[model samples]
Target: MSRAAGLSRRQFLALGWFPWLRPRHIGLAGARFRILRNGRSLRRYLRIHGNEETARQVLERHMETHEGIAFVIESRTRVVAVESLQLDPNRMFSRVGAEANLKLLNPGVAPERVRRALDLLDRGREKLVRALTPPRGGMTIALHNNSSAYSVTAEVPISDQTSLREPGNPHAFFLCTDPRDFETLKTSPYNVVLQQHGPKQDDGSLSRLAAARAFRYVNLEVAAGQTERQREMLNWLEWFLP
Candidate 1:
């Protein structure tokens, strides 16, 4: 068997015999896809349109053919021939896991709105420093956990609440000094994990959160001054779609 086939077999065994494991059920003839549902890998087949071109055409047709079936297609492997055609929307959503939850926090909010909010908060950095100057009424802006050395005279007090919130609307932006801070902010009723500067976790952060299950965690690595650290941080976020 080829390496890909061997890997598939191993994945099948890992799924540990469940009714959903059958390929026909998921809409594929031979290819099998399984996801952990309630702690067990539930098997399902993805209806793929053979090769890349066909898949693209089918997906394009699907959107044009049907109204409101928005999707983004990413292929790490080249598509050749039309192989299958059983794409399940629910499966795709499940694949997104925690990021989906974050999106849900604010229903009906456009992506651009959230982007603007983040931009606003980032601009507030200068204001934050000015506001932190000379501890008036105990209002201050601290870094990670330390006080800012510089001080400025600004009437507006800087508070952490500006960038973070509980019961945050999906449209609101959340900020953290580091990925570790972000991971720690997650709470019950949502499942997301944010990790600090490190190699990408093997299991995909969303899958881990979904299985273990906690509020969504948005990992944001604070940019360090070192060029290499900043590069690594950007590279990591690049792999992740906002």
Candidate 2:
């Protein structure tokens, strides 16, 4: 019952042969995570970066009582696939991002190996992206935690719409990808930004892809361990966005 190293790739593949082992329970992308679907259109992701425990706690608690699907990465670090590669899971959504991630993670990597990895990820990325996207009109919410250094100012340069509260804690804010959502969130007490329009450069994060598809994506970012604050914003979103 321990969550740590629950099953090896070989064991997982062996178990998949049994009819009882459903896809929801089975891991994806080398057994990185399991998707829990609760008869709701809402989709959520946590622990994309292993150290974001505050985000993980908030989402986990929210999922327990709400009807939705949540993908919980089973790693304590940012790098999920090929740990040695040091790639960020959030950057695996787009082709350009994936290429950059592989290169960044594996500096001086052989071109042949990089190409091979991209070929493999391209296939897996399609499945993961589909799984991440919610049912029609549903929202994909990703929770993240930031340290002191990361703040709203850094995002302001690329933000198409922004509502920064005077003296508001920059470490805690929201990054949304829909204009209407931004309009609504701007009225709220927290800081919010709209990136509905793509910035000149694309880092290949989920937000960019979601924006491209016109999906309603909300990212709740807060200082690490600010569970109460994060939960409040999440609850506010359910009422405001719905």
Least lDDT summed over 10 consecutive residues: which range in candidate 1?
A: 138-147
Angstrom error of the Cα, residue 222, model 2: value is: 0.4
What does candidate 2's lDDT look like per residue over 1-242, in tens digits? 36325988788678745644546643335437656655545555544666788877788788777878788777787676642355677877776887798898888988777777667667777777787786787788888888888888788889998999734688878899989889999989889999998696677798998888888898888888889998998999888886
**What lDDT, from 0 to 1, does candidate 1 have?**
0.27
> What range of 10 consecutive residues in model 2 has the weakest lDDT sum?
22-31
Each prediction's TM-score versus the true structure: 0.17, 0.85
Candidate 1 lDDT, 27-77, residue by residue in tens: 111222221123221111112212223323333433332222112223323
Report how far off residue 51 is in candidate 1 (Å).
23
**What value of lDDT does candidate 2 attain over all alpha carbons?**
0.77
